[model samples]
Target: MKGEKMMKQNQQDTPLYTGLTRFSQQHPISFHVPGHKNGAIFPELAKNTFRDILSIDMTELTGLDDLHAPTGIIAEAEQLAAAFFAADRTFFLVGGSTVGNLAMILAVCSAGERIIVQRNSHKSIINGLELCGAVPVFIAPEYDQTAGRYTQPSLDTLRQALRKYPDAKGIVLTYPDYFGKAYKMEQMIQLAHTYDIPVLVDEAHGVHFSLGNPFPPSAARLGADMVVQSAHKMAPAMTMTAYLHITGKLVAKDRVAHYLQMLQSSSPSYPLMASLDIARSFLATFSQQDKDKVMTSVKQVRACFGQGNAWQLLPATKLDDPLKLTLHIKQGYTGFQVARYFEQSGIYPELATNTQVLFIHGLQPFGELEQLDNAIKHVNDQLKFVEKHATIEVVNQFPQKLDTLAIPYQQMHLHDIVHVSLHQAVDKVAAEAITPYPPGIPLIMMGERVTVEHIKQIKHLIKQGATFQHPDIINSICIFADE
Candidate 1:
């Protein structure tokens, strides 16, 4: 017990942050890169705001330790993170979870190899598969009628895929779907392992799951071979900061490290690395009292919304993360309109869809309940007076339980592409991915055969003022030319 207490206390130390601070205090002369010379030559307008941060925006210096080959402070910080997250090894990602996803996929699967992928996975995961020239067998997620969104694929679907493709190189998944809904992740992982298939998870929004209860269990904890998390998403870290953890040795650690060094920038930001260290300390030091306070504040916010009839909170299940609050707009009002009203009141939600808006609460207690209550009351009253539109009835986007690309990624570049109207896109193969922002899932993935349902969903989303990552493809989309 004493040894455990001492180890817990040791997590408080921030080696990388301390090293950067010590280096900055020396008033070191800059005979190096970054022409700004530590904020000295920075633009006058933003100099004041960026002064302190720029001071530590260093490159791979003598004391700073290289990211590709961490030997000192960075190695220590990553070691601490591995211990905290209960992984065999951990790597600090300077390029967000995107790079981590790419590295893991590239490391595990090669050209022409089969990989089982979640259909509703973020674009990054798809992009990774394309980059590595792997053939993806997509398993569509099961739509949660209660939450009105897609969660992880059902275990039966996974079992069928495993039995059909026993030679699959790996399985890629997203836990706690964009709406913070989690399914039987552990069971899924166990099932994959029985086939000797490694599970690589894009757990970008689940960094805080390490805090324990009130949050779903992290993929790393559930025995995923490789788990990548975006620290900046939920933790108080700068953008692009992330962590990559390797649990058991289903995938080679050296190969992952090799791909990361190739994919990530040669010069990593010291400030970003330092923020990762601080974020880790933040989670390691979070107490039971802190969790209780955060939960209380979350309940209070829910109560505030509950008092009104304008919004209906998505019912929480046992596996749902308490930090995510999804509210369905009542009375045919689009969530985009409700989101705009909230923005006018200076309250910006995480994202809004045709039927619901999602709010992401931090680990700390919400201190502005009064302001939030006022915003809720104002939105409710104002929405009553606002114009109403036909609500887009939610439907299953990916109807098929299992699918594969009509045209493989390697063969895509050889095809000629042409643009066609949304109505004419049906029965045509897509040349590019058309994705919805916020959640970042591709509605029509590259090499996928576009269907009438895809056009219908896109049209309704457009009518409701939803934003798309490929906004240029709204009226016309690029499709593979008929051979």
Candidate 2:
């Protein structure tokens, strides 16, 4: 009630931050989850430089409000966010979009229920399935052979999946994928609703889409029941800060909130929650003029590396988000080489695969066009575009229907597993997910049979120096032993 009164008094100000500021003025004594005790415990952090952040790093004391039970400032901050993103309700997330995904899945479907999910979903989504005990009916995302990347899933694919799994509780989508390629989400959502199915979107790379950008509209705006976004990924928010939006009558807000409390930390990070509020305020005040300026800078960066250059920038299609800049390596260098060069020149990219390097911008407060231009010039000056003789392209003979270790009915938990050498693991069900880092898509999902082709692909990636999460102990994989 006191926090509510304070928020009402400062109605024009940022609610969460206003509550934090007022609480800090009280100079309350310590004894909380964080052993730092307002940074007093850490002698090094007690220095002037860290004092500003550490001082305000308070817990959910009186008037500060609890994230799990948001009855005061935290609730008010969520209200502001809901209005900004045009959602029924918005919950601040400190555990990043990963936790948001888990909550959404757990809240939407009960144990043993089925959900149609895209095969290209981030590892978190699969983990969500594991946690919720939901059966995944995987539909392949549209693959771009030229770019060597997975794009959005087509409406037809969703329609087919829905038809096959008519009793499915919901459908999960990874919108504006890691590369920012958004599909016809509005139409897709409409189609899903026609079947009386709720849509849950993993808009992790698409928080800025809702903002005044030329990119396709965010899934939240187009009737998605649940939309999870990593504000830290694109917005001017601290890392691990995110927002989980709930809308429509299909999803119960209370259940989502309850699941969030279960999945998220009991002692949520105040700084992370405050950052969400600040990021929301930042985006709320963004104007059309600001959009134009960011776009102009982005265009200049694109123009700097056009045709006839060693590297070719992937043209932003109508369905693509203009902010995500992907460069396809042409000749004389691989994506890894180009990325290494950029890093050497004090310019790190968002991600780099064997075929392409990605440069993400336009969502943050400032676009790094100047640094990008200099990086491009440096790369150009350092490397020569040498023409290579044409060679025969070897067609990969992928197994048409690689056997899976587990059937649809089998409940494959994340913990039930065994680790075996890759060669011996063939024909065995994967106990743990084997995913690549940059894309984060599983090469072999848990419960799926590890095929010879999968082993060949893993070896190929290893040979190409691709980064795998569990690569230290090479040739070993986690697969469910015969039971």
Candidate 3:
């Protein structure tokens, strides 16, 4: 690896992110909890006298399957989930997929172990790296600079990465990216299994994919060793509701369970658990007519964008989620401006930066193309008032290739990180995670050496108006601890 560094990561052996579950049973003495009191958010429900807010909140008890030990209702619910996603085992998550991801990473990998990760993975992965001190092999996916968006890395790139680091712990891939672009997971899984390594998928925006078609294979079905999904992202489930699934012998269930207990909240949310079950039930009974309606609605929006010379939809090479739509903003209007336009119409997209604007359709009920049609109508009208802005930019389309390194999964002690400027960031040990959010991939990780070109690109992205993990105005980075 270029600029590879020999520094230790400062992350805990397991997870210390169970903040939510830690304060779960904090005796409600009142005068705290933001005073929402849960007493009057709804006059009728609050006054209905089912159970006091304090009484309703309880930890794992009789009839309640312990999240750490799913043998009761949680087990039953998870069984239904296995059927829903067609996985061998499924476990519910209370603190969102982020916690699910932390648990999965910690379970499959130890501190100082190497894992091939997308340069755009979620910040939590970086947190895992810091906690477990894993060495990250960063790979850039297909970045459509013109559109200001990124797609999945090509298979060639991933394979090369494997060849380069045959000892790597495994791989973590994001499905239906922030803007909705997805790689063919089956192929990635097939290649990964050949090496006897696990594949951890961050299916945050893809819970609904397992419900029906037009969407590609969910990670579990594609043979990933472990997969995490954010149910709230596309389900009627409560916020922070999600799940983790195990499908292969390479990943032991007890190992995943121990890590889940270590990283997740012990006093999980009961409502959230019930929501996951109900949402799956809702998804199970959905009609083909409804799926068609969802598809038709999105196609109309794509058609409208095609009408305007300012943008174009990237061609689909495989089965893509009909609800995940990314528009290559053209005519000098960046993803930022287009997102602003959607904002005016009260139509918020899933994500947008200088190059791409993504509109995610999760809930079929609230997802109506007519609303988007109205929004696009307003945008097209506004564009006419600007310059001869119809000229499209050069479309830089790259084939989806990947490179995998022979990185291994290991553990290291936590320490302070050494920081440097963007110019000198490369070749030095990375103390922090430099990443892009909408796609949730890291540009740099814990022990990897940064490069001058990497720094240059980071600066360019900032100048082009891209955002990173900005902890403060003076500091744009927070690195790993020094050895």
Candidate 4:
């Protein structure tokens, strides 16, 4: 207990943030890049809002240290982060988890090499596969009826993929579903390790899982070879800030670094890096009392909605994160419509789907119970005048246990791309990934064949007023031109 206390005390120090603060205090003049000149040459109208932050948005100067070849404060900050996350080493990512996913795939697999991937992964994972030119063997995740969404793939499905592709370079997976539902990730990692296959996890939403109990375990702590976390997602950090952790020996640390250097920008943001430093400290010092307070506030908010007939909170599972509150709309209204009403009442949720709206709470106490209760009342009142739609039933869209791209990533450019109407797209190969925003999971990957079922799902989502990342999917879709 004493040792743990000492560790927390040590974590209280933020090296990079302190360094940046000290440097900004010096009021260094502008001979550097970023013509803002430390917010001196900023727009008059926006200067008041942007001045303080721009002062710290500096470049690589003495004591500031370069991110690619860190030797000073940057190294110290990353080292502290590694210790806090219990990783072999950790790299600060300015380009968000997208760059981390790309670096992990590029470092481990060569062109045409097979890599096992989860079918329900974020579009960034599919983009990484395209960039690395790796052939993907997709394992579909089992749909969770309780959560009303696709969670992690079953163990048997992973076992089959491993058996079929024992020579596969690595296995890539998303630890928690978008709504914070986790699965048996530890066992899945062990299963992949038995075949000498490294496991790379895109744990973008589970960065705070390291807080322990009440929060699900992070993939980094569960023996994954590589884990990428978007610190900005759950932590109080600037957007696009993330961490890439090297946790196991299966993957070469230097290779991961090399890819990150190649893929990331030469000029990184100091403010974002400092925020990453602060975010790590925030997690390292998060106390049990803090956790209890957060949960208590969350329960109080849940209780307010529970007493009303407007919403039904999704029943919590043992592995579910309390921060993620998914509410099922009970009055036969679409989540999109309900979310709009909440927005009108100045209450913004994380994201909304056909039947559910997801609310993401922070590590601190939920401070607005009265406002939330008022928003619920507003929704209930407004919903009375709106026409009710039939409740959208959840279904397993990706039913196949194992599937592969119709055209390999390397061969995608060989065919001519053409935009065709949805009717003509049947039995054709997709030339662009059709993904839903917010969750960012691809419904149809670029190299995959377009099936009638795919069209049906797309039409259903469009009819329900779901937002697609590529809005043109409603008019037409890009498909490979006839041989």
Which predicted model would earn the best TM-score?
1
Order the candidate numbers by TM-score, best to worst: 1, 4, 2, 3
Residues 1-483 of candidate 1: C-alpha lDDT, one tens digit per residue: 998898798799999999998998998999998889988898899999999999998888898999999999999999999999989999999999999999989999999999999999999999999999999999988877788777789999989888888999999999877778876789889999988899999989889888888688888888999999999998999999999999997999999999999998898888999999999999999999999998898898888767656678987776888889999777578888889988988999999988889998888888888888888888888877977777767566778888999999999988999998989889999998998887799989999999888898898888888889885766799999973
Per-residue CA lDDT of model 3 for 1-483, tens digit only, reads: 332221111111111112223333453443433234433343565566633433334455444457677776567667767766777898888889989888888887787678887756787766765566677776667765533556677788888889988898989888877655566778888998889889888888888877556777677777888889988888777789888888868888887888888877666766667667777766766668878876776666667656644567755545666676677776566676677777899988778765567766655534465667788878878876765422233233222243222222242224455554565454555655566565555665545556665566566556555677646413444344342
**Which of the predicted structures, 2 or 3, would earn the higher TM-score when compared with the native?**
2
TM-score of model 3 relative to the true fold? 0.77
State which candidate, 1 or 3, has the greater TM-score.
Answer: 1
Off by over 4 Å in 3: 1-58, 139-149, 304-309, 363-371, 381-430, 446-460, 473-483
Every candidate's lDDT: 0.89, 0.79, 0.66, 0.89
lDDT digits (tens) for residues 1-483 of candidate 2: 998656434434588987897787777778775777777777774467777787788888888889998899999999988877879999999999999999999998877888888777899998888877778788766666655566666788777887778898988989878888877788888988988889999999888877745868888888899999999998889999999998989889999988988988898888889889988887777768888888887777778656325578888877788888888877445677678778877888899876678987655334565676787777776666533322212134223211222744345542456778989888887777788797898888877777788887777666555788875537588776653
State the lDDT of candidate 4 residue by residue for 364-466, as single tens digits: 9888889998988888888889877676464767777889999998887889999999979989999999987877899889988888888988887788788
- The alpha-carbon RMSD values of the candidates against the true structure, listed in the order shown, are 1.2, 4.4, 10.4, 1.4
TM-score of each: 0.98, 0.89, 0.77, 0.97
Ranking by lDDT: 1, 4, 2, 3
**Candidate 1: stretches off by over 4 Å:** none
lDDT of 2 at 104: 92
Each candidate structure's count of clashing pairs = 0, 1, 59, 0
Candidate 1 is scored at a TM of: 0.98
lDDT of 4: 0.89
